[model samples]
Target: MIPQRKLSLLSNRLARKGGRRVPEAVLERDYCLSWFLVGLSKTPLIDILAFKGGTAIKKCYIPDYRFSEDLDFTLRESVPFEKIQAYLALAFENVEKDSGIKIRISRFDQNVLGLTDLPDSGL
Candidate 1:
């Protein structure tokens, strides 16, 4: 669970800019997704091109964006398109069920897929 103090600080910053702060439930879902990716990265099925947004910014971006909710990763060129789609669907389903939000995943290419939308409620 995210520390209450840290969540408050993040909430304050997002409120100041009229940005929606991620809910605690959503944060937990994000954590789960992160670990899933980490585990998958060690496998040979996919290359895990990039895990961008919050974690990436925290580790790579000079001045971090402070908050990010989605996980972004790429598949290996040799991986079949069907497998990529299946993985994303399952990942998004897990996140949506856990967070009580609706997540939509889309592919820009055979190897590049993204979490397109996450509704505020599981609508």
Candidate 2:
């Protein structure tokens, strides 16, 4: 888990040295997104999941692009919704276990699983 102190220090440093002015909230969101991806990469679903949307473009293609607050994914294969839910549960659990970031499924439908970090985390 990344200590909040370190995150704060890094954010301050970036704020001092940049023209774009990245906010702490955006940095923290990016951090959580990174850990979630790490957790997903450790699962079998990684083979079928393709990272997409603005977040993907920001992280992989253009580092200076506008920040994104959510994650988006596209499945490369036809998988059952139940199995996708199972894998997502595993991924969320792994994020909490490995990074101390509690993520909950705030909303769900056939197409999306909305995730939100718990309020008590103070991230």
Candidate 3:
């Protein structure tokens, strides 16, 4: 659970991106996804995948780049599809078991999106 003080701080920080502050639920989801990604980097996925786009901008380069709900990754080199599959499996399994956040991922060519359930949004 996120402490009230931290949530307020995050919300304040996120408010800088746009004129209005982002909702708490969106920030919570982003925080959850970020935690999942931190665990994901431990798997072989980082060796073959390069974090890119919104996720990178928000988490790496700029913290106030808006809330990114999905994770996007690009292939760093010539890695076999099987290895990539294994990487996803291992990473997701570990994160799910640890966080109880069942992140669903879909891939298209060179991009992958991590889909997650909202705080109270049914389905």
- lDDT tens digits, residue span 33-63, model 1: 5555544444443454545566566445644
Compose the digit string of candidate 2's lDDT tens values, residues 1-123: 466777788778877776555767778889989899889988889999889999999888997677899888888887888999999999999998898999888877455443443346657
| Cα error, candidate 3, residue 8 (Å) | 8.0
Collision pairs in model 3:
none
Candidate 2 — worst ten consecutive residues by lDDT sum? 109-118
TM-score of 1: 0.41
Give a tens-digit lDDT track for model 3, residues 1-123: 577788888788757756688778887888788767877888977777778888789889887576777777777676788887778778778877887767666644553333443355666
TM-score of each: 0.41, 0.77, 0.66
Cα TM-score of candidate 3: 0.66
Give the runs in model 2 whose Cα sits over 4 Å from its true position.
Answer: 1-5, 109-123
Best by TM-score: 2
Better of 1 and 2 by lDDT: 2
User: Which candidate achieves the best lDDT against the true structure?
Assistant: 2
Structure candidate 1, residue pairs in collision? none
